[model samples]
Target: MPLHSLNHFKSVFIYDIFIQPADQNYLTARFLRVIGMHQDFFWHAQQTLEKLFKAGLVLNGVSVKSKSHELTKLLPIYEETLGSDAFNSFDKPKKLKAELWSDTSVKDFVTKISALGSADARYGLVGYQSSKDDLFKLDQLVFKLRQRTMGLDWVIGEDFRAEENLQHFNGKTYREFIEQNPTEQIRHLSIPYQELKSIGENTQDLFHAWNFEFQRKSSDIDKIAPGAIAPELAFSLSRIDALLQNIEAFDGFDKEFVPEGFKWLLDNVKVSSHWKKMIETYLSESKK
Candidate 1:
């Protein structure tokens, strides 16, 4: 019900729901570029990251300028609000972890992604193209930010389900709080419970699509050679397999809701031989 809680919720939802999916779409486009799909990656990524950066600023109580897309410029605002120590504590993407943390590297990373927001990248104002490395860094940076914002509502003692004051934190109470606040930002944060529910449901849908649809449809897959597919897709499949393994061990969500392929993937993961076998089968079948 508090402002911090609202900010945390907005930041997390924007990053996890909107931004994360856009990032995955960007990644998927890299391997499955057909027409304007690559542009989808660039534009959506720039827009999402810009909003995410602004949300981060709002979360930290830093003033956000209206409609800014230059994420590198926001770094100073973050530093001023949260302090350099807090910013430094952030765990960057794993690939960049070994490198010594520097303001320059951070700025460079942000700037490169921000450049995608330029008219050239968005509308082909001039000759411009995004590289694979650029896309990869954008993916990693967004992932880290998404993870950072994930449990913030709980941290701020604003989780409606966990907080003792259920009546005060309920929808009616939150609506009343927004009315009292009378800020454009507060007014805009009127998130329906169903909308929140749909975010989780949509993620479940993605899992189902990947497991049942993408993996099930033999023609949907592209075989690079006799027994190998694109490395990006294989890595993604392995990651999904690992995700299912973790879920099975952790037992957080309803196992009944998990698709059959997720279970099968985990079983295959245990066998270790199944990955190679499946690829071989795919290749042989494709030949046929």
Candidate 2:
């Protein structure tokens, strides 16, 4: 490969760095939250979400150059780029969407989290009123948005074209190009393929565990809940519903929701092994 081709090839891995910083910010924010440092926690939480937001933009072929850290600005761009239908992957996604975009909950989250991105929040110059409820909402946002940054890779050879003769990666999907190319001989990239592969795989695993394993979605509270309890008869309704939300509503809520619960549900909730293979076959065929 020519010198320019090598440099272009090396530039392909730059997108991978976004996830690293996002993960670092997330870990630190969780640490701060555990120690009851809400201000510092919000500070790091803003950064973590900002990085992931920008990463999603870049991955989807959007320019984030000179973008503001305020999610108010970035979020509209994100919604336009990815669109509202992006939440279709989540269970009871409309509820989640309303929580993020339409409801007063969104106002509280966006304004407060956006304020935390300011220098005042960083230096402890201002005290924020965000509560643990905000933290749980933050966890949900991260879990939902991080999914956008997870799959696929973005590396365009045309953007770095010195000419037509030098094209090592082109006209192929990311995984296909990486697999077939003789990148081992090229010492130009700081990271080898194995390291890049490991990072991509491990990030998804870590992301799922860190964000959701112990966390419960509010929708989980409605697994057996009625559509509406009668408003006319009320005093005992509040206490009864409170008991369900806090205690016996369903499987994946509060103390019942944990990594062990997650694993056990996965292990036990599936159809029997004999039919699982058949289900997998149907799924594969449906995709085809």
TM-scores of all models? Answer: 0.40, 0.44
lDDT of each: 0.44, 0.51
Pairs with backbone N, CA or C atoms under 3 Å apart (clashes), candidate 1: none
Per-residue alpha-carbon lDDT of candidate 2 for residues 115-146, written as tens digits (9 for 90 to 100): 98577988988877765356566666766556
Error of 1 at 249 (Å): 38
What lDDT tens digits, residue by residue, belong to model 1 across residues 80-195? 65443223333344566444333335566667656756667768664446553554555556544433332222332343232443345354433343334322122122221222
Positional deviation of 250 in candidate 2, in angstroms? 51
Cα TM-score of candidate 2: 0.44
TM-score of 1: 0.40
